[model samples]
Target chain A: MSMIGDIARLPAGVPETAARPQVSVATAEDYVALLKPRVMSLVVFTALVGLMAAPGPIHPVLAFTALLCIAVGAGASGALNMWYDADIDALMTRTAGRPIPRRRIAPGEALGFGITLAGFAVVVLGLLVSWLAAALLAFTILFYVVVYTMWLKRSTPQNIVIGGAAGALPPVIGWAAVTGSITLEPLLLFLIIFVWTPPHFWALALIRTEDYARAGVPMLPVVAGAAATRRQIMIYSLLLIPVGASPWLFGYAGLVYGLTALVAGALMLAFAWRVWTRTEGKAATTAARQMFIYSILYLFGLFAVLLVESIAGRVVG
Target chain B: MDNKPDPTELTEEQKRSRRSRSIAIAMVLGVLVVLFYFVTLVKGPAVLNRPL
Candidate 1:
C-alpha cells in the first residue's frame, strides 16, 4: 500500500473510538480497541524502562509475566474509560462512532469487560509479582475511570493535568514490581510522563476543540480558546526541557541521552512557539499535530537511549 | 377532605409509584451486576495468591 493510504487508514484515535461503538460488532479488533492498544504501546515501553532500570535482577519468565500484567492493567484502564465515557461520547462527533455509541457493543458489556480485566490484571500482578505493583495498578485504573472519567472530566478545565497522574504511574509500578520499593529514578520517569501529558493532550484538544465543546467536556482548548491553549502548550513545552533532562541530570542515563534530550526538547519548544504564533488554520493545526507526534518519538528516544547506554557499558566491560 | 375509594381502582398515583419502584430496582440490579463482575470475574480469589 502507498504511504498515504497507510496514514489514512490509521484510527482517528480515542475520541473517535467512542463515536461508533456499535460499529465495532464484537470483532477481535473491537476487543483490542477496548484495550486501547495504542495507549498500551507507550505504557509498555515506559514500564519496560522501569523494569530494566531496577537495581537487581528479575527472572526472565517472571519478568515477562510482570510486563504482561502491566500491559493487561493498562488495557483494563482503556476499556473502563471507554465504558464510562460512552454517554457524552455519543454527543461528540469525534466520539459518536465508537462501539458503544454506535450500538456495536452494549454499554453494560463494556463495563463488564473492563471491570473483569481490571480485577484480573490486579490480582495476577499482585499474586505473580508484588502487592505494591498490584496496588498501584488498581489505583491507576480507579484514577482513570472514576477520578478522571466520572468526576473530573466535565467538572474542570484542569482535568487532563490531574488525570495525567494515573498515566504517569505505570513505569513506577513496573519498577516496584521488581524491587517492591519506590525510588527517585522511577519518580523521574513518572515526572517525564506527567510533564509530557498536557501538551500532548492539548494538541489534540486544539484539533478537536469544537468536539469537546459540543460534548461539554471542558478540555483546555474548549474552555480557554485557541490562543490561551497555544500559550499553555508553549508553556508546557518550555518546562519539558528541564523535566526531560532529569534522567541525565540525576545520572540514570549517559551523555548521549542528555544531548539528545537537549536537542529534542529545544525542537519541541520551537514547534510549540510556532504553534503559539500561528493564526488558527491548517498551519496551526499542523504544528500542533507535529508536536503531538514528536512527543511520542521524544519519549521513545529517551527510554531507548537508556537501554542502549546500559547495554554498551556491559559490552565494553 | 373526605374520600371514598373504589374497591379496585387503578389510580395515577399508584401507577406512577410502581414505575418509579421498577426503575429503582433496575438501577440497583445494574450496579450489582457491575460490582459482581469486578469482584468475581476480574479479581477472582484464585489469582490473588501465589501459584501452587
Candidate 2:
C-alpha cells in the first residue's frame, strides 16, 4: 500500500521535460495512491458481508485473512490501472495531479507494485482460505487490470457496464470463502452491487465530462453526453431498488434490512431524478455530486442493516 | 510522462528534492511496518476470537 508520493520517488525510468514538460519524476507515495484505497475499502466491506452471510462456517482467523487478501487484490488492480492510465490521467483535470502524470511515480514502478501485490494476495488467500476464493480474487485482479483497464476502457463507452463484473465479484468471493462455492445468496449480493455501479459511477461521470474528454477517456458522459448519461443513471437507479430488496424477500434478511433498502432506494431515485431534471450548470454538478456521495451512503447503509439483521437472527434463532 | 529529464538541468535541485521525498517515503513505510506488526503480530490473533 505505498502512497502516490512513494512511487514519485522512483530514481530512474521517468521521463520529464520531454512531452508536455514541467514534469518531474514520480516519488514513492504516488505509487501507493495508484491503488485507490477508498475504492478498495468499499470492496472489502462488500466482500466481508458476503463472507459473513454465507451458510457455512469459517475459522475467524481465515475469514480475516481472506478479507485482507481480497482488499489487497483490489488494490493491486487499482495500481495496475494507474500504471496504464498514467498518460491519460495527466490530461484530465480530475486526474491530472495523480502520481504518474504529476511526475510522482514512474509507470514501471506502479506496474511492479501492482503485480507484486496481486501475486501476494492470491498466495495468501490460497493458503488461508479455499483455493476458490483465491482463484476468484485472481480473476478480479486480472479482469480489472486487463479486460477493463487495457481493453474495455479504450474500446467502448459500455466499458463500465461490462467491466463492472470485477467489482461485483467481491461479495461472491466472500461467500465462497465460507461456503467454498458460489450460491444464490452471494449472487444476490453481487447483483445488488453490479446494478448499482452504473448509476453510481455515471453520476460522477456526469460531473467529470470535461475531465474524461480532456483525457481521451471514453467515459459515458464523454461518449453519450450529459443528457443521455443522466437518463441511463436514472434507469440504473430504478433497477437497483428491486435488486437491493431481493435479499429480504427471499428470506436472507429481516424487516430491518427491507425497510433500509426501501428508504435508501427511494432517496437514490430522488437524487437520480433530480439529476435528470438538472441542466448543464453548477446545479447539475451539485446534483451529480450529491448522488455520488449519497449512493455510497445508501450502499453502506443497506449492507449495515443486513449485518444487524443477521446478528439479530443469530441471537433470536 | 516525459521520457527524458532535461540533461541541461543541474543535478542540485533534483537531488535535493529527491533526498527529501525519499526520506519522507521511507519514514512512512517504516511507520506502516511498525503498525502492521504491532497491530497484527501482537494483537491480531487475540482479536479474532475476541467477539462483539
Winning candidate number (TM-score): 2
For A1-317, candidate 1 gives per-residue lDDT tens digits of: 02222333546563432332122225444566678888998898888888877777666555666777788788888888888899888998877877778766677778887888789888867766678888899999899889999899989999999999998998899789888999999999899889989998998888888889888899988887888888998899999999999899999888898998899899889888888887567998888888788888888888888767755654564
The digit string of per-residue lDDT tens for model 2 on A169-214 reads 9989999888788878889988898898899889888888888887
Candidates' chain B TM-scores in the order shown: 0.61, 0.61
Provide the TM-score, chain A, model 1.
0.89
lDDT of each: 0.79, 0.81
**Deviating ranges (above 4 Å) for candidate 2:** A1-28, A315-317, B1-52
Off by over 4 Å in 1: A1-25, A312-317, B1-52
Score residue B52 of candidate 2 by CA lDDT: 16
Task: Say which candidate scores most in DockQ.
Answer: 2
What lDDT does candidate 2 reach at residue B5? Answer: 56
